[model samples]
Target: MTLAPVEYAVIEFGDSTVTGDLVPALTELVETGLVHVIDLVFLSKDADGTVTVLELDDLPEGTAAAFAGLEHDIDDLVNETDLQVEAELLSPGTSAVVIVWENLWAQRFSDAVLASGGVLLDSQKVPQDVAAAALAAHLASLD
Candidate 1:
């Protein structure tokens, strides 16, 4: 069967701490367009290593290959820069990022994300109205 296109989002929060309502947000995203909910990734890093795990209903079609490249790019940027970020993707269509702050690394991260055919939705860096719309749109999908 033809799978839905993956939509990704990287919500970069200013707090740098994990937030709740992720599931709800993702639900909204799927309900918006005709896209399927693919893999959801949480991009966090600590002393141990980087955390880039999926958190959505429909897992990405080509997760292994997509994530391999994503992992490499994420590692390189994190090691060379300071970006507390989180990434979430909705299969072939969209992705969002939440970052502590905006910096040059944003471009690099954006490139990596787009390369994977993901959109970079930096909630922290983006306008409040836009975020609200996204959140609202995502939430409305619950119905």
Candidate 2:
């Protein structure tokens, strides 16, 4: 099947528990058909710098149940190397969730581009702070 672009993000909760609070927002994205969850993995680093990786089944009963709805059959797309690279960014006593998702909203556009023989040369996500600064500058210029 033709697929849309897939992207992954690692969200870190410094020195905190991985509460399933973000589940609702994620559920909304999926339910809205904006994106499809490819894989999700949880990681934590202890005070001694020991890293632990947890899949859905490895999470606590409550946490696991909360995240259960987000799971799809497309698993293991985020491998050990991917987890390790993200884990290195976590501080001791911090936890993170790595989520890989298909940009379902862009599927049609991507398919059309392919059909037209167009190629994607590059893509980049601007940092939030930089985007905010640029917006502020533009607003100031308009004043």
Write candidate 1's Cα lDDT for 20-122 as tens digits: 4354544443355323333334444333344444332223444333332221112222321222323222222223332121233244565667679986465
Give me the runs in candidate 1 sitting further than 4 Å from their true place.
31-33, 45-143
The TM-score values for the models, in the order shown, are 0.30, 0.95
Pairs in clash, predicted candidate 2:
none
lDDT of each: 0.39, 0.89
**Tens digit of per-residue lDDT, candidate 2, span 48-135:** 8899998888888888888899856578888889888888999999999888899999999999999999999999999999999999
- Residue 132 displacement in candidate 2 (angstroms): 1.0
lDDT of 1: 0.39
Q: Which parts of model 2 have CA positions greater than 4 angstroms off? A: none
Worst 10 residues of 2 by lDDT: 13-22
Steric clashes per prediction: 28, 0
For model 1, the run of ten residues with the poorest summed lDDT: 68-77
After TM-score superposition, what is the CA distance of residue 143 in candidate 2 from its true location, in Å? 1.3
